[model samples]
Target chain A: MSTKITNKEQVEAFLESYDTFLFDCDGVLWSGTHLLPHVVETIELLRSRGKRLIFVTNNSTKSRKAYTGKFAKFGITVSENEIFGSAYSSAVYLSKVLNFPKDKKVLVVGEKGIEEELESVGINYIGGTDPAYNVEATDASLASLARDESIGAVLCGLDLHLNYYKISKALLQIQDPNCHFLATNIDSTFPSAGRLLPGAGTIVGTLITSSGRTPVALGKPSDEMMNCVKEAYHLDPSKTCMVGDRLNTDMKFGEKGGLGTFMVLTGVDKEETILGTNPLVTPKFYADRLGLLYELLQNN
Target chain B: MSTKITNKEQVEAFLESYDTFLFDCDGVLWSGTHLLPHVVETIELLRSRGKRLIFVTNNSTKSRKAYTGKFAKFGITVSENEIFGSAYSSAVYLSKVLNFPKDKKVLVVGEKGIEEELESVGINYIGGTDPAYNVEATDASLASLARDESIGAVLCGLDLHLNYYKISKALLQIQDPNCHFLATNIDSTFPSAGRLLPGAGTIVGTLITSSGRTPVALGKPSDEMMNCVKEAYHLDPSKTCMVGDRLNTDMKFGEKGGLGTFMVLTGVDKEETILGTNPLVTPKFYADRLGLLYELLQNN
Candidate 1:
């Protein structure tokens, strides 16, 4: 049943037959805005071959609209649907499985992107709404929810307003075995515009550390997210291709979906990582960038 | 030569000579607010025996004032000089070693404790005034600093607001060989009120990870902190007993100082850890809590 082959030739053959393509934004396309020279042309070339392109990023700090804007800045015209971020996928999954609670008492403590996702998903996002953004207010609001009986489930995502107290409140509520604890993703950290920022994963980690319990991760490399890609795109596993930079997130997504994975060494993951550390999601195709990948395709 | 006595009695005989006690605050005395029953009495008992006590925490979050206040709230009275948290030590070390520039600019991303320490050390903290308080502000301020040449060192500690972007910026500053990098402590993570919070070690992890450069750690288990404790108290290591929860931090502190390390499984480290993990500092005496320790002391 596992059609996923590690052989380069077999994967290339599969890519030739696939109708849909998935690309990881960071490493595969460009390493955070320094565009590889021929990437746009390569996508255009793939489009000419009747391949559907989907750009996915595990970084949930940015919403799809933000991605669209960033892509616009990067000179790539990507539709909101064509781009799938972990935030988007997380939101979509929570909406479907979590039977939108009526109490709508959610203690949201993530970035603007996560807040946007929650509101879009029909879940009542409730917590400290300080324009000044006070952690004290966030703490009290969350603690109030924890003490409340109406609050059903606790939804967690990447919160830019980070702290120990914020997570303390969320764990206070969700620690009850009756409640469902769903996380945006399991990425412990992310590279942002700042120095280094804790991701939704860190928040999720907070909950796990406090309660000694794991939350249901709704985003990338999780079986659920992979299925989302499969069902929506109607992916023929043998023919589909996944191109990404990170071996764990992007490449693993391909592995789960039984597609050929291409690792581009442009972003977070180094060249050595593909060969050295993670053996689970090793890429079938290794390229410097997506454009370079297309160049190899063309030269051959 | 290593001590030849194997039985627990020899440990008691050895500890009888020590005149000063170096105690790690969190894991040994208590895990957060809940105190080990005999902790106060044991300290009182030790004090009655004419032993000097210094309570230390590797956690860089709060200052001596905060710890003093926290202990006061728990109905314990201890002097400021008798306390040694990583934040205080780092500040003291930085003030002595690092040459200040004309602007007095340092980018800070930790909590109140680390802030107090930095101020005490005469470090003019810049970047977002709120240490990892707001994401947008934290990100914007840090991103600006990453590109700024005026900024000297990115001073970091245990900021519960830890994330990827901030670490990225710290790395950016550290990437230049000209920049000085300092970590408050090297504890990978810490147990907070609810969950596992990223420790000062994780902050250091970002620098070592991105720039492939190790930092100068000024906190616990680092000979600097140990030496600071010894000189401040005028104590003989052979006669003193070091008590704490963690084998790595507290026990190691005792071990490195050549003091008798007694581990109490009441805080961050458990008895399971003693049995499983190879502690760098092996406690001459090990027990469940201060009460058990008291019983052992009487019998031995």
Candidate 2:
């Protein structure tokens, strides 16, 4: 059974229980280009209440800097330091957690966000958004294909310009026994402009199937993402609450991290999903929407 | 235990047992650009014995016509009717078995081979090497992306020109409840110029993960390919022998189709793979290489 946080008392109690709040942006705060009602007010209220806010998103398509710009578009103020997207998390995991070698470069099979994050972490990378790799591959190209010996890792994410040349290069790079394979996230699909589009998982899944190797995925629901957050913030798990709309990524991530979870039915999951048998992951608290928290807090 | 046919008597006995022979081209007949010695002699011998020869390949990159041209280059003449490549098989499966509606067309995410095969069957298709769909997709393009309502199926195969636009279009088309999702083969990698390259399965696997739907795969190790061959040549499974280099695709295909399987140690699988305990699928007979049959026949 999940507690429904509806009234002002419940909202105040919930707020008092957690000093740190981790939010999944896509579903809870907004959906696609439309911002959910009262999100700006609720977020501001939480900020005023001294909540340490962290926007943790599985969208690896955008860097922290880009996310800050997107937040501004939503009429919300957020610093780059407050954002932890899968691209940033993956870079953190590689540079900080894995202690990726300085001499070697990562062969990226993703978009510019990944490259930007890797650059922020001072990690040398090749192939992401490279015009040479974006072209159509032929027999001659495939035959003469060569890789830089410095490529020690293959990092992949949601790549819009995913081409055979890139996949082939990544596949070849990962063939070396010493090469590490990493993925930003394995999100199968994300809501986009009123429809579900293929996500990073599709790209990673293709590589996994082609290369017959699974990558170390750094994103929501994975302990690595949680670990990245924990190491960066140095926060106590018990004092943190993960608020999101999805069960598999957000709620499961919270549960795995041993943090309190709050499910907002503004995203992929529904109320029945929370109450249903064999639920993927049960949240500690459930709400009709994130705006409900705003109404509760305002009334108080 | 797999019986290893070594001598003239053993080879003669093996040939006499099966009326039809299905050969996997790459490793058995040739590897890369070089034709394996004695393959032409062996194939000629089989034809002289009144045996039906069917070249069954999981390589969807080429149509039957293209395969025939390749065979000609190897000094071995094979008609398009004798070739059952994944591209041809998938086309046959959709047009002949599925009896796809004439009013509707297939949205292809593959190479020119698939387009040729579909055209040969008089099936209307969009995409597949079309310059419009091969371009990189942008936010503007994705927003303006439209689907042809007449697209009732999404067919995929090995596509070097795979891009976001094609994947997105296929993803959207398959969203229709009535649209059929079809794949030429799910072979993860295929031998190419002495190295393994990502195959059609990689492309199809991406769509499968993204769409959250599995396609009806029509290639080696699946009965659909066998059905295609049977329909084309009137093959009786019991009297047919599948000879190939790979255990998983070729041998497994033969075993699943209830045909006698002959393992040729010239391609992906090694001798230990067939002799090892807990083998995936045991072939009915084994040989050092397909050329050994030529030697045995010549000696006889």
DockQ, per model, reads 0.13, 0.85
> What overall lDDT goes with each candidate model?
0.67, 0.89
How well does chain B match by TM-score in each candidate? 0.82, 0.97
Strongest candidate by lDDT: 2
TM-score of 1: 0.70
Candidate 1 residue lDDT tens string, A1-300: 123333446435645766878887765566544766788888887787788998877767678887788887877788988987776776776677566666656666566676676677776665533343344433244334334556666767766554445555566667677767777677755555423444566556556655656777767778777776676567788877787767778788788778877776666776666666546666776765566545556553
Error of 1 at A64 (Å): 4.4
Cα lDDT of model 2 by residue, B131-190, tens digit: 888776799878777667899899999899888878888888777767899999998987
Strongest candidate by DockQ: 2
Pairs that clash in candidate 2: none
Question: Which CAPRI quality tier does the interface of model 2 achieve?
Answer: high
Model 1, total clashes:
29
lDDT for position A178 in model 1: 72
Error of 1 at B280 (Å): 9.8
Q: How close to the true structure is residue A274 of candidate 1, measured as C-alpha lDDT?
A: 65
lDDT of 1 at A140: 46
